[model samples]
Target: MQTKSAARNIFFGGTIFFFVIFVGLVAHSYSYIVTTSTNVKTLTEAVAHGKKIWEENACIDCHTILGEGAYYAPELGNVCKRLGGKDAVMGMIEARQENEEDTRQMPNFNIKGKDLEDLAEFLCWTSTIKTQNWPPNEAG
Candidate 1:
């Protein structure tokens, strides 16, 4: 019963409506990322150095950060917060132990000195990123 012209009008109207909605969502996401997701003020030389170490060692091969890497290891997005800060993070890295019965263990990366400090700083900075409560639990 509908006229051809009316059907065409409906299709065009729906396309435009959806396009507008898509644009709005994209803009909102950009604004959120620029304003709330990351802290540029805290990105320091140490953090950059830590990130370089992370990449050089291929840490992403075993661990997930911000939910983006392999799931073989625990997510480290909030490790600084969970473990209580930079010193604790370094301690855990330095003191990693392997139980005989455990099938999986974190190998000692031999990270020390300024490298250790920088890596900790990187992790702490990562912890500060707003993930909207990702990993969903304290264990990650």
Candidate 2:
């Protein structure tokens, strides 16, 4: 063990051991994410459509959901709670009116009909996900 080659061997062995551990952890995380993180029951047509709308409208560009996305706007993870349940969530989203006053702000997405309902439903569903406590702040 006192030899230089012995020391080098130990170093390489430790590196390989840590690398294996890291790889194992990554594999476990991937499996867990695939199997447990999402609740498939909550993933309905409405949630899918709502997710599509979110992507199409680039809502993540301004808002964070479940603490993921740009920080420019408030987090929509627990928005159903923040805004007060489904009706309130729907109200806030529906309240956006197009203003021609020349101001830099959240634009009117003009979400209407089923699309509006679906989007709100998606947010409500998101609030119910098992985050183990995230955003950790009143103002996300």
Among these predictions, the greatest TM-score belongs to 1
Residue 53 accuracy (lDDT) in model 2: 86
**For each candidate, what TM-score against the reference?**
0.75, 0.73
Model 2 lDDT tens row, 1-140: 29999999999999999999999999999888767777788799998998898889999998988877988878999898788888887887866545646644778888888998899889988887778777687665
Please name the candidate that would achieve the greatest lDDT relative to the true structure: 1
Q: What is the C-alpha RMSD of each candidate to the true structure, in Å?
A: 3.3, 3.5
> How many clashes in candidate 2?
0
- The runs of at least 3 residues in candidate 2 whose Cα sits more than 4 Å from the true structure, single-residue gaps closed, are 1-23, 98-104
Determine which window of 10 residues in candidate 2 has minimal summed lDDT: 95-104
Off by over 4 Å in 1: 1-26, 97-103
Write model 1 residue lDDT over 8-87, tens digit each, in one string.
99999999999999999999999998799998889999999999988988889989998889889878899999999999
